[model samples]
Target: MTRDLKALLASDQTALGTWTQMVAPELVDLIGLNGFRFTIIDCQHGPFGIETAENLARAADANDIAVALRVSRNDPVEIMKALDAGIRHVVVPNIETAEEAETAVAATRFGPHGLRGACPCCRSGGHFIRNWDSYVTAEEARTGAIALVETEEGRRNIEAICATSGLAALMIGPFDLSVSMGLNGDWRCDEVQRAVTEMARAGTSAGLPVIMPVFAPTPAECRDLVDHWRGEDVTTFVVGSDKILIAEAFASWAAKLS
Candidate 1:
């Protein structure tokens, strides 16, 4: 699965996926079966607890799709819990320094590099092996981490953040990044564009893949933005959220009725 994401990132392929606050396993199964390369469980803004997140992860796994989580904060407990729930990849928001990035990596990794609390009985550890040595080695190899470059602080420290080893990729949070640039929701501002471009370059230099979230004003606009980003060599594009799809469909039907 990591190989697949890496391939998409390397070749700049358009990976279509959605963000969900709803942690229902059925929804996860539906999305995964539909051939999404990945599904990001938005634990930060969504009402997902550890149990629900785990269920979603299991559902995705059953369908052979990668299940990733976006943490609410850069807290160790939050990062550790997500990893233990069988989420192979985690996207941490608002990372501002190499130290924070290091902390995140440590929380997700096993001994030698990180201090992630040991849990032999957890699903991640294959259910509490009596022999500790084998479990630790396996855990370290499976987990992956991603740092979000959202705020101006994170953007300014892009090179440092990307320089951290064990990080899988750097993701751009369009809304947050736009606000951080003082554009206040204006994603088209020249400053926002320049910052994203710069960050993409930084990711390339650091040997990390860059991911961008596209919340377009319209479906046509979404396709256009995807094309533009693909041209720039951004392989992973999170197209839209479930909320947007529902609201747009409902509004369109309502307009037709009216």
Candidate 2:
């Protein structure tokens, strides 16, 4: 169902997702329809306006896929816009402290619980055809706010960050984290591995699960990676993106043609 992602996350069950870097709604639908439990609409690097993002969100939901938006910034407007577009999950990047995590959560809710502006006519409120306040209350209950603990500073403070009340999960930004630790993009380096392990431990201690990313160059490699994380006790992971899938397929085609 559309609530599958939330249910899985809430139950501490394994939730699998895929990245959507392109603005194409068709790709979003296909990603969800392909059996992924969730999809992250990457707004940070993907050029999409509120309308386009909303269209994509609707597409994913129509296929019974939960949608999350990795907003461009932790700014309240960016977060609000994402939710207003009917996305139930919001991922804020580069969160290094509890205060930042709180802010991310605050941006997703109304007053008392949060500071999100309320509008009855928006997609979030069902276009003013229903009770606005009731809609806000219900939507917040279904929402998940995830914090990206990417940098060295962020990883060091991960426990406290995860301790934020409304923050749902800690998402590892592998590339940025590798660069932050001076690993020079060596995600496989021993030092980088240690950092990853420590970060996961911190989240575990805080009573939160870490959202890991599974990246691979081939389908078999992807399966192996998922199995490895499952053995490592990773309850949630996102598969590689539409971009990576196309790249892999194209590379294989070029090799065969050669």
Candidate 3:
């Protein structure tokens, strides 16, 4: 059976994913092969462009792993391009209001339901026009947009953001959220923790999945952090980015050589 984010979301399992800034599709295949359930192609902060993201989606499909594209912004064109590239999910960043969340979700749907532009020959439609009806239905059932709320204003309006219609998930952007609150990017501070708890609570109250990153450098620390967030109702965790993981490994190896 094909792996799908929808299945993961509906299940009670703790889904794990990684973020990649590198533009190589092989990295995505490796992520899946290494047992990650999903990978977010980090176009917002990473170096991914439309073409590269499309290629990454192909790799994810080959590996039977769920993939989400974090668009550079919550623009309709960006969302539409990600979808056309065959990515089934989008993570929209910096949403501070229910209206913004609504806009992001709306870009993922078609007519009467959304403002997404239609393309019968897009990669999402199998690059053909023969099965348009089934394609539309499948897209409606499978595709969704996640809201990344990570600012003081966003924290204040998280409940409303989670209340937005058709939002697939709520992700707490810890570093940005801390910095936005004048904490100097200290995601470990109490203020940031409280805000994250509140956001997770709001997400649960709204019946949405909550996702947060566990940036701890050690396996023990990562486990502790996951346990901490799990207590707050966070269902998904992104352990680290490709760059961070590689850099850390390189440093550890160099230390051993010394």
Candidate 4:
């Protein structure tokens, strides 16, 4: 499969994606088919079993949506498992140092940088076919490894992390970053805004795209951010999470009933 992610980001296209907590295969398939450019199978906080993850990956593939898995940690086992299940893109959360970023790159690969045990039975390895070598090579070329920088320390180390050769992008996890900076959920605080802006500049200077997850906000607010960033032409935005949508909907309904 052609990796359109890099191209999409490069072209300054508005690629819409969602973060899913519902990891069921059917739901994943439905979301993908509904025109989501990509859907993240959130393994970090979402309830997703290995088998279900595999099924969801397959469904996303079938529906022509890119499957990116958000691993809870920067563990090699979790990274390899997600890759084995045919997830080509990975978002590793809370990467605070150059060492962590290096470790993440290693985990995503097969030999040099990582200790990933190759399994021919895995979907990514072509089920151990005679063409396994070709499969691995091609897969390696298309795979994306994103580092989520969500801390004051991570912000400080942004340049080093962006300089890492294999890193595809630097993702800003605003919530965690806000808390880390003692903003305590005040994402609009001057300190938080400055940090995010500097991080974006660093990533762009290093020739890496910056990705930001836009949480629950009015459509106008979302558009304003998108327009601003899109004008810069170096960042990709993933619209709000499914969990937030569900909560908002329920809260609105409760208000109506009352």
Candidate 2 lDDT, 199-248, residue by residue in tens = 87777777786788777667897788677666666778888888987788
lDDT of 3 at 11: 63
Quality of model 1 by C-alpha lDDT:
0.79
Please report, as a residue range, the 10-residue window in candidate 4 with the lowest summed lDDT: 1-10
**Residue 4 error, candidate 1, Å:** 6.7
Which model, 2 or 3, shows the larger lDDT? Answer: 3
Between which residue pairs do clashes occur in model 3?
Answer: none
Tally clashes: model 3: 0
**TM-score for each model:** 0.90, 0.93, 0.96, 0.90
Return the lDDT, model 3, position 44: 89
Q: Residue 109 error for model 1, in Å?
A: 1.2
lDDT, residue 193, model 1: 84
lDDT of each: 0.79, 0.80, 0.87, 0.79
Local accuracy of candidate 4 as per-residue lDDT tens digits, 98-192 = 99998888887888656566887877766664776787687777777899999999998999999998887888887889999888998877888
Candidate whose TM-score is highest: 3
- Residue-pair clashes per prediction, in order, are 1, 1, 0, 0
How high is the lDDT of residue 10 in model 2?
A: 57
The regions of model 2 sitting more than 4 angstroms off are: 11-13
